[model samples]
Target chain A: MNWTLMWDSLPRLLAALPLTLQLVALALAFGAVLAFATALLRLSGNRVAVALTSAYTFVFRGTPLLVQIFLIYYGLSQIDLIRDSFLWPVLSQPMWCAILALALNTGAYTSEILRGAIETVPQEQVEAARACGMSRVRLFRRIVLPVAIRQMLPAYGNEVILMVKASSLASTITMMEITGVARRMIAQTFAVFEIFIVAGILYLLINFVATRLIKHAEWRTTPYLRARA
Target chain B: MLDLLDSGLTSGLHGWGPQLLSGTAMTIAVALSSFLLGLAFGAAGAAAKLSDSLVLRGLAELYTTAVRGVPELLVIYLLFFGGSGMIMAVAGIFGYGGLIELNAFSIGVAAVGLISGAYSTEVIRGAVKSVPYGQIEAARACGMGRWRILRRVLVPQTLRFALPGLGNVWQLTLKDTALISVTALAEIMRVAHTAAGSTRQSFLFYSVAALLYLALTTVSTTAFQQAERYASRGVRRA
Candidate 1:
């Protein structure tokens, strides 16, 4: 099973871990903000807002992340206006393009998750908060959003793991992340089996840690569910 | 600018229509093949997970966790590159040394099938678990044999419970086929990719690709919705 090859390649694969982590962190951060806005807009009871937001979610969720990444990187670059605009500086780089696509894709998914979770928050509590003379903003901030966040964390954790996996798509666009580096090593070393196995392990470790963090977050959020530790 | 955009659209549409249509067919074919293969694997996986054996359960766990944890691209890459060698090795065991070359479509199906199977295993297992134990007991009391009980009692209920989850897995399997375009298969993505590069109308080609995908998703979503309704025929929703 070439255990030595797997062991030897571990360090080299680990070298690209930082970029992978950075990509996940940035995309997830931006996706969360985008998701929050999207969820609210969809629930805002305005027909235009609802239609626009759902269409946004529909398109992103329907298409593949690879296609989205290509659309951002190669497709948009083919446009003359983008090439001449100020936005080109950010959009031209493969890394930024990958981030934008990943962020948008995850945002669409997380928004759906958030919307479902928020809907499941009891309506009576919202009414009670409002009955206590709480302002609309305060009612949402103090009563609704916190409960929704707690309910949504587990599903959001799944989204986070999905995002981490999706980050590998960045490799197709010339980003030197974990999968990208593994491909480069394979090209040079001609060790497809060994290099990918090591890279797979690295990815597994990252997801494992992510799962644990999500578990911890779940625990922290629902203090009522935990023991009196 | 408007003239340029209009020309690009007409040229891409007229020039690449057949290729795009063929590519869409290839995408659906592969997605369906992979999904059926996944159902086979998922059934076996669910049985393994449910079996009263530690080794079988652990193996099922490992398969799902490892496959689900790793990216689909890497799995596809592994199969795309190493598939021929693996097949050759298998053939060698039977005294056949002829070269084994696998087409991208088959490899894509195998890769996406395994991924789909991992998720399907969880869904099927959960569905199986949700079936009432009392119903199985009653079936046993009726002198129904194990296989008979499974066919008469369990399968129907499991299908009802598993329909929605399986629908999600189908969507996922369909989408993962896009990643399989890496093998240079003439799928929707590959066709659009080629047309884009050749025509220098990248935006036009990609938007068409996206619309094609949306059409596929919409149709499948409606079909699944209908299936769910049909499966849940007499069951009441909470």
Candidate 2:
């Protein structure tokens, strides 16, 4: 337990916290939209849409995110067509590549969570909304979405924490997040245990705070459920 | 694209088929070893968590929370770099300290096992809880000892309840082996990475790796389904 070394590494690790948070935030934001679309696609009663979304979830969830990250960062760039395209600017940078991979991976998991939540919304509530002559979009907005979001908040919180941890993989592709900084420090100092223990504590702190925020959000959103208590 | 796939698959001409297959085998080996190790740890942790001792329960809680919160990659790195030192110190206590070292495979299994064990502890604990208390009471009333009651009454129902969750943990363990590639282990992901780097045909190798993983997940899912069915035999369902 090298307390001084752990203390010295804390500031450096903290400096990289913004990048880690940025990756997680961007990925979760984009992933939420992608997840919603995926969930809706699965429920749209269109065979092609269902098949496509299912395949998307199956592939992403089945494979390791590291493989996806490497394939996107290193694999996609190998193709001359992509390298020459206008999207090359975004695809070539490690930051964008990491974000792309993280968003796609989290999107798959979040879609499943969202889909399960959506499915669990009572059939009677949806029927009542439809019987009232609410438009399809209105019915979904007024009846389905809110309830589903409430049901899925805890799961989504887990997803967010996972994304935060997953962002560490970006360091593998040369992105200098917290784990990246820790890796570099370890390489230079050979103090692997102390640095990583500090890094682990930093992650623990982030997740602890995130868990509390999620619990607070849950309590706020479910006031009806909490009224009796 | 078809030509690249052909060459990559064919045995004689620059095909990485053999290497990829070997890597897949190694991946399975690592996953299985770690899964078993995880089950052992999970059983112990579940017992500790369910026990009456405050210290035991606190220690179990600490293990689960810390491992669950931290990233798998960081855990692997800590084990990979720090493991040898810890092992050497343990050996020193036994008067056999001659540069104790762990191979990549051992470290990979140990690290991933620790992570898998945390999740498994939760699963097994939940499963144990699901077993009806009346049955255990009945067993005790029948004059059976604790060990006999555990074997005859508790373990069976717990395993049945825990199977699906254990299946998920197995998938998690399988995918986590990818992180062990950082330690330079020649698992499926590592092989794909090395082949991709050398051949510059990154898409082909990585796609193959991804497909291999999907294949493993699919096969194991079916196997688990069969096991679930088998476990539920003679039991009524609503």
Superposing all C-alpha atoms, what RMSD in Å does each candidate have to the true structure?
Answer: 1.5, 1.4
Model 1, range B33-145, lDDT digits (tens) per residue?
Answer: 99999999999999999999999999999999999999999998888888888899899999999998999889999999999999999999999999999999999999999
Error of 1 at B196 (Å): 0.9
* Off by more than 4 A, model 2: B1-13
- Quick one: best lDDT, which candidate? 2
Error of 1 at B119 (Å): 0.7
lDDT of 1 at B228: 91
**Where is the poorest 10-residue window by lDDT in model 1 chain A?**
A183-192
Q: lDDT tens string, model 1, A105-166?
A: 99999999999988998989998998899998999899989999999998988899899999
Q: Which TM-score value belongs to model 1?
A: 0.97
For each candidate, give the interface RMSD after superposing the true interface residues on Cα: 1.4, 1.1
